[model samples]
Target chain A: MAIAQAPPRERARPARAPRTPYVLIAPAVIAMLAFLVYPMASVVYYSLQHYNVSKPWDNAFAGLDNFRTLLFDDPLFWQSLAFSAKWVVTEVALQLVFGLALALIVNETFIGRAVSRALVFSPWAVSGVLTTGIWVLLYNPTTGVSRYLADLGLMNYGAAPLANPDTVFWAAVLAELWRGVPFFAILLLADLQTVSRDLYEAASVDGASRLRRFLHITLPHLKDAIILSTLLRAVWEFNNVDLLYTLTGGGPAHQTTTLPLYVATTAAQSHNFGYGSALTTAAFLILTFFSIAYLRLSKFGAR
Target chain B: MMTTQTTGRTLDRPALPEPVRLPRRRHRRRSAQRVARWQIYVPLGLYLLFTLVPFYWMLVFAVRPRGSDSLLPWPITLENFDTVWNGLGFGIFFQNSLMVGVASLIATTVIALSGGYALARYNFRGRQLFMIAMLCTQFIPGAMMLIPLFEIFRTLGLVNTLWSLVIAETVFQLPLSLILISGFIRNIPMELEEAAWVDGCSRLRGFFAVVLPMLRPALVAVGSFAFIHSWNNFLFALMFVSEQEKFTVPVGLAYTLGEFSVDFGALAAGGVVAALPVVLVFAVIQRYLVQGMSAGAVKG
Candidate 1:
């Protein structure tokens, strides 16, 4: 009893060193805040006030007008925002599914798996400009693959995909998908390795069929990965300009013009600085919401 | 999906305990495997074929004669290459892209390695908040920073300079690099560094000698990523640089097409020339890129 009492007395005699992980992380924090937070704060400030590009220094405070215009008065803004919604959802969903399916097949220990993965990953190396160029060539009316198909009694009208306003959006989406799918394939393959083979073996032993096992085990296990992958890709898709710009330059009649292209056209090409900044500010908020909601949602289920 | 599964499993799995029937079951299983293999190959083969056709077309366009009307029926010639070399300033643009890509890679990699190392090794204050903030940087749309970034560069008298594009691309490169490297650093056990420290090496020396070598894979990953990001950068280059000589490949190629439309041959030639380095670099360092992307995405 005396020995135990003495041990307790010694243990309680000195307090543990205070845990301070923040001290180590200060540099990254400062770098981020300086580069990211400061810019974001400035964006908010600019959005609230009337910011003129030509007369940048002549700052005037215009409370909610910028937001009002962005929301209700601007049809292009709404159209572009709506396009982004459809754009990210359709692009990301199909890319993820196709990528996952491809990854699953390639992940198998089959002949030529390495070559297959390499071939698929080749597109990831090609620049946005090259991908767009190839697609544009394919969509050419006179001498492209589409025309060839039409000549062979396969396709109808032979109208180029990019030139058709109603179809231009899908054309842009496909171009983006060609670039985007490899991302999911690569990332999903990574997560797939982290899943232990023992789990599959055990499930199979329990007479769980592959389909049931995939749904209950693989899908559930891939939750964190799926959410993270989708979010990252969505953020990218929201900001992506090269694919859309190269494919259609916002399109036959602004059908494929995304928020980024719109902002670029407005500020740089059109020289409407104040309104452009206002529109850019709106785009930032929308993207910010996408990111924050994603983070919070993922964080909630991250156990 | 359900029918495919049912068929696959029925043709693949069987549960029985019999000695004399073993050879028959084994024979049956062998033929079933063959059938299953074909089924798997069909869809995958078609997808691969569909995906690669465009790249095939690109190659065709690149190598064919300049005046060839048929993009498909091609007598492959070096004439297109010659035209691209002579007419489009392909050599100059190629050199500029390499310079900018390498510079951004070096700058971003150095900063990320040091910063990521510091964050990983020390159990200090504000680490979580710092990481979250780093992530927050990626959250904001890249286009949002265009005007402000352009304004800053203009004020600093960096417009129309390669320095402006380099810095802008570097800024774009930094957050992702840091984030990716941080994950790799965290994988390295602290005991390794501690052992070096106990052997009389200073913290900085331990980092350089001990930690840096272990970070080779992550370095390769981040370097390749930085290279690609810089190479593909169009918006910043378009906004910042106005001089013809200062143009990077993407912006230069984009400009090949004016208001009326594109010049396909010249654009195709430029595209081919521009993509060559990318393909070469990828072929050499693809292992690292895959490793890095997978590693980065997992932690993220």
Candidate 2:
């Protein structure tokens, strides 16, 4: 094959190269199939079976019983799904607003831009557990920020935000927001940099106001980036359980339990793999539908 | 059209008066400078406080004495660090996390490099399907895969082992790393590789001699992403590894948080320890991060 296909000048190279790509991608394909795709398929399979590690005798093919229970009987399922929706919307929206602002601010030629970029974006690298740890200290009643504020007669001492049901949602939101916003800032800033300065200059020269310039040039340019980052962040915020698990423990009576957290609880604490897989399936369907809807509605990359 | 009209208007305006325009232009410039200054600094200042205060609070609690409320760690103490490091077994967790992180980094980069090269260089039969599959995997929540992954790991006898974490992290990291590396490899001209081949180098040797050297930044970006993600991963480490010694940093910190009678100082200390490596790595690679995202993500 090599000799037949080869021209005189390219005789050194072989035409037995069609299989090279498959061979190269074999490891990745195998790994993803083994770890990722296989697990997903198993989740779907187990969602239909009564698989519980604790109760071996009860294990049998459930055949949509888990889904039936999830859709009809489970109040916590609805509650968690609602909370996940609320959580994702609130976090992504706020993060986008603040992150875009921060990106715009730092994108300017400020004196301390380098240091400020590093400092402000540092929280992004911190883990969810670590973010929980830091916020736990800040929200601590006795020796935390409340005590210091109380010392200055600004607010009451022993104000336990995480413990209070009324405040826990906002408390979790604020903490997650701190770490989450930097992601938007970093991504938006990246896109912001690619916006040609000449566009802005041309707009300004045309007597366009700053807001108009942004609306016309910068915003349009960042349309696809904003869409991509928000979708990714929405999925991430919906799936993330680390901060809520540690900070509030989805507590004050499961006030903050996202669907993923609920699934984790079911699987880990109750050992109900079947129910957990059902919840997993539900969450997966919701995300897939939501993402597809979001992309379609946003008209992603249409320009 | 807009640019031409604006230039034409500017040309017409210059005919009115040069002398009158000078002071007006200077006045506009001054006010714009003033507004721009406030616009940059005020919000940035407030945001910096928001960003830095939590970190500062963590540092204060980590360093101050158990009972002190001085706000500042005037008399710095390492007692919390000492207790968490040795007593709470974070020492073992740290070592485990490092092993997992480094191992995942190596695995993700090497595999992604091969897969990315294939994607970039080949017009293979299943190329479109492969790319689409990688994209679809992004929507599969890691948390949802816990039950099945746990079952898989248990079947493989990898439960309570760090290899479970390494494998899980590598799988999750592969799609993005592969995409990013392929995007990068696509940017490098094929002529360079062809030139190397023309000099009697095999395709493999051409890649190593010509392409690999140019792929340093992409490798670093992909490698660091794998390391940071694996190091911070909690669910896999929590579910797969039950033993104390097999714990990662996140699992250790989560346990510290879960204790009924929480020790603030030790928790803060553990948080700091968990934060150190990733933050440092982030600080170094952050410049590339924006660039990498722009190149690999936005375009894709």
Cα error of candidate 2 at position A198, Å: 1.7
TM per candidate: 0.87, 0.92
Give the alpha carbon lDDT tens digit for every residue of B24-122 in model 1. Answer: 454344323433576568877987876788777777767776667565636777766676677777777778888999998887887777676555555
Candidate 1, residues A1-303: lDDT per residue as tens digits? 010011111221113433322433344455555555666676667677777766767668888888788888889998888888888899999999988987777666668877787777667777677778778877888647877777779987568777777788788778777777888887788777677766765665476767877898777777777887898898888887777877787867778778877988887876555677678777766787877787686772455
Compared with the true structure, what per-residue lDDT tens digits does model 2 show for residues A1-303? 110111122333357876888999999999999999999999999999999999989999999999999999999999999999999999999999999999988887768888899899989888899998898888888867888899999998889999888999999999999999999998899888888766765566677777788899989999988998999899999998988888887887999999999998999899999889989999999999999999999998788
Which stretches in model 2 have alpha-carbon errors above 4 Å? A1-14, B1-35
Q: Considering summed lDDT, which 10 consecutive residues are worst modelled in model 2 chain A?
A: A1-10
Clashing pairs in 2: none
Query: By DockQ thresholds, what CAPRI class is model 1?
Result: acceptable
User: Which residue ranges in model 1 land beyond 4 Å of their true spot?
Assistant: A1-37, A54-59, A156-158, A295-303, B1-35, B67-74, B259-261, B297-300
**Chain A agreement with the truth for model 2, given as TM-score:** 0.95
Candidate 1 TM-score on chain B:
0.83
In angstroms, how far off is B87's CA in candidate 2?
A: 1.4
Writing each residue's lDDT as its tens digit, candidate 2 over B120-149 gives 777667777888888789888888888888
